[model samples]
Target: MIARKFWVLALGILMIGFSSSVTAEVPEIGQKAPDFRLSTPDGHPVRLSEFTAKGTVVLVVLRGFPGYQCPYCQKQVHDFLLNGDKFAAAGAEVLLVYPGPPADLDQHAKEFLAKQNPLPANVHLVVDPDYAFTNQYGLRWDAPHETAYPSTFLIDGQGAVFFRKVSREHGDRTTAADVLGELERDKAAHAH
Candidate 1:
């Protein structure tokens, strides 16, 4: 009986792992980015479409307030903040997604942005309440103590994703310089 139970439990765990992986849709390059409307930490509604016409968008997906504040996410945010001028010079706007359970999600996002009071105009931090945007983008980590994988996408004014980096785990992410380089390349291509 004990051996039978062990096999059954193992099967269940396998099924869960498989299902989780199947759920997330990888955002492919050269595809139209999934449009989404989510609110800022202070309850302001912002849509991905709003930035499509103005300039290139640096879309950042974070492992938001999952059971605790992700140190990697914090570092990534700071890295972008440090390179704010560079992003602007590249004609890019950075929009970050903070996702978690629906309940008190805004509050958690608020706490997460506590250090970034009066965020720069080009930097917009939005909350993904109830994982709506997370699921839409197929980035939901779907594991215990995790919200969504860390992903970054560079979208052009035409609304097509030109560059994408989706990290299955923490730490593997696209750097500011990397994104800036892509923007420059895109500009050069267009100029030709």
Candidate 2:
């Protein structure tokens, strides 16, 4: 019995270690943001590095079509849209990541955007097929009936992450006002 218990504990430990090793860590402030290319609904490829090359990038990972459209995600997107002018003035490009299975992903993205007004020129919605981008950024929720964890990252022109917020729950999301304030602070800090 003692030997059997020891083997079970060892197997459990090994499994835990393996799982932790596979999970990616969230990019910290001052770390270079991971570059990824995902397609817009109309098939244009959007690359993170390209956006960062021009100016600041607000990378938002939304809970996309997880059996149903997430209301919180909609509200968050709407909030950002309401602040479109401010974001544009700050020279920040908002990249909204809608992630799900490859099948019907674009259709779902369209459905999600249907309720909102047309996206501002500064905002771009990209699809993450089969959670590739989510896993790459360590934001995959990996639970039944769940999608990627809602996250927001602020990357400066240099491609370095200056701010980030990852929400484990659906409702607690970073607000547009919060991000705009961060942008102002970041700009002031850089000036000095």
Candidate 3:
């Protein structure tokens, strides 16, 4: 009986520690998007600031557990590939982010890129393992049964966000069509 009670206390402490570390990250819209530098699978270092080329920058925050490939992320990335040209036509940059613990990043990023992904010339896939960038943006999920809530952000060249989408569940997410449509609308609105 004593041993069981002791085990319960230990588990409770661990849960508290785990929750604090992850649940604290909450990125919001209309704020300056956090800039980060991370390496791709081929060791190319990419930064969020680099994508803001005279227009809005779309940031796709993905979950990178490496133990499992997330379906929502895969679908969203695939959609981006299919509509890459439309985004290019709009003159917007697409930046995909995969965040996790340091150890799983490289392997998971490779698996992520294994499928033929024809991103637009302005699109970039970035690794943000360790949640360094995610936590700063307040978009880290950090809960059980979640890597991160699938979130999308549209940042202006000055690094200010004009639009953001954060899914309440893994099944709900922003897609390529949605992003392209948004880019068109924002550009039109600002142009006027």
Rate residue 76 of model 2 by lDDT. Answer: 94
Candidate 2 residue pairs in backbone clash: none
What would the per-residue lDDT of candidate 2 be over residues 4-63, giving only the tens digit for each residue? 999999999999999877977889999999899999987999999999999999999999
What is candidate 3's TM-score against the reference?
Answer: 0.80
Q: TM-score per candidate, in order?
A: 0.85, 0.88, 0.80
Runs of candidate 3 with Cα error greater than 4 angstroms are: 1-27
Cα lDDT, all candidates:
0.88, 0.93, 0.77
Residues forming the 10-long window of minimal summed lDDT in candidate 1:
19-28
Candidate achieving the largest lDDT: 2
Q: List, residue by residue over 63-154, the lDDT tens digit for candidate 3.
A: 76635788778888888878778877887788888877777677888788788555568778878777767777677786774556688888
- lDDT, model 1, position 137: 86
* Per-candidate clash tally: 1, 0, 4
Q: What's model 1's lDDT at 20?
A: 72
Provide the global lDDT of candidate 2 against the true structure: 0.93
lDDT for each residue of candidate 1 in 12-128, tens digit (9 for 90 to 100) = 999999987676476688999988899997888999989988979999999988878898999889888888888887888999999988788888888888897777779999998
How much lDDT does candidate 3 score?
Answer: 0.77
Ranked candidates, highest TM-score first: 2, 1, 3
